[model samples]
Target: MKLKVVLRKAYDYVRYDLKEIAFPSSLPDPPHIKKRRKLTWEERYLVLKEASRLYAASWVRDIGPDLRPNDYKKYDDGEEKPNEVNGATKEKEPSTLEDLAIAARGGMETLKPALQRVYMTRASAYRDALKSFIEGYKEGVQQVMEKKENSGTQGEEDSPKKST
Candidate 1:
């Protein structure tokens, strides 16, 4: 008797409950897709330029205190000695942006490597994000195209054919 009751309940669940769950009366609406526009070259340049300036400012602010001129001073009986490296006097570390530029010997060559690394890192990250965005956009476009084709075919099948 218990086995019979259990089998009947299982059959009812499979027949009625499973059908409603698998094929609901209504489905939720599809999500709306929005198009994303690419940035213009001038806008991209300005954004990267501003980001570089901010990054440089923060880098300078963090290292400024450590590079103070007084930190390198040598007191020797009222005479200051220059920093010596391998028995030869070495130039003092620059404590300000102006001093650093001057120390660079009048060209941007000294700063190129560090700035290049920063730009490369930023460019790589931007490239990855843009790649992902483009891939998703393509997928969305494909989905929209498939949906349109499917609907068009269904509409034709459902409508009566008119004689020409």
Candidate 2:
């Protein structure tokens, strides 16, 4: 084989076997890259609050197979119409909350829309409700933390720890 052809084949083989390649130098920082900074105490609280709200709503979404997230709070299970339960007929079809709990556990298949009647309406309502819950829970946690901090400072002044 010609020298050039032999070299080309070897080069092609190496290239094909290589799975990845690295730049000769570091690439530019991504435009969307964010700085690493600790969140302020309040921001941390808000983060926790929001997480809790999302978690709560996600659980609520697990209602019956027919139920959607929107109706999780309002839909009544058909059991109320008179369905046999545990060996006997129960009173209600099962409240929205009950269905959700069951659904979360993999009992139900779907949920009906309770409040999200329309498109924009549902998106807006769900967004607001999640924000509200997050803020409320965050504030509650902050209040408790403040109370504990205050009590601790006062305790130090009023009755400092002493060696036995």
Candidate 3:
């Protein structure tokens, strides 16, 4: 009884509600996808740098005053490696749009709407920009490490050693 009455009411509501609205025979084609403007290398670099700094600041802010800038250095210097000294592998931490938005918010109520708007408006582009920046950064670091190791080996060969 009550169940039948509820089902009938729902069906009537949907049927009447749908009839009141006008729908074209064929739905209009979806809006064409626009080509997004490309960012220059410098612009992308800046975006990545700013994003990193903003995220780091947000982390510190979330932790409150007990944590300081120097304390964050450990995170900056440590990279996840399978063969770490203790054989413990480090886990990679991924950041999301919400995390970025919260960091960019800086706890200001007035900024929330603008932050959300920008995030929604440009999230894809921003994500790609960050991706490129991080890839380039990793490549640079690897090259530097290779160079340092090569120099150290060359120095050892060039230096005189006592023979037993």
Best by TM-score: 1
lDDT against the true structure, each candidate:
0.75, 0.67, 0.72
Tens-digit per-residue lDDT, 1-164, candidate 2: 99999999889867764433432446778999987898999999999998887667667634343435454344366534222245554344776567556555663343334322344566898999999999999999999999999999998899967889
TM-score of 1: 0.33
In candidate 2 the C-alpha lDDT for residue 61 amounts to 31
Task: Put down candidate 1 lDDT per residue, 77-150, tens digits, no spaces.
Answer: 65644432345445555454555556467568766754566578789999999999999999999999999999
Residue 150, candidate 3: C-alpha displacement in angstroms: 0.6
Q: After superposition, which runs of candidate 1 have C-alpha atoms over 4 Å from their true positions?
A: 1-110
The per-residue C-alpha lDDT of model 3 at residue 46 equals 100
User: What is the descending TM-score order?
Assistant: 1, 3, 2
Clashes of 2: 15
Task: Give the per-residue lDDT of model 3 (tens digit) for 24-101.
Answer: 256655689676789999999999998887777776535533345544433334664332455335545544565556
* Best first by lDDT, ranked: 1, 3, 2
Candidate 1 C-alpha RMSD relative to the actual structure: 28.6
Model 3 TM-score relative to the real fold = 0.28
At residue 81, candidate 2 shows an lDDT of 28
State how far residue 10 of model 3 sits from its true place (Å): 90
- Deviation in angstroms for 145 in model 2? 0.4
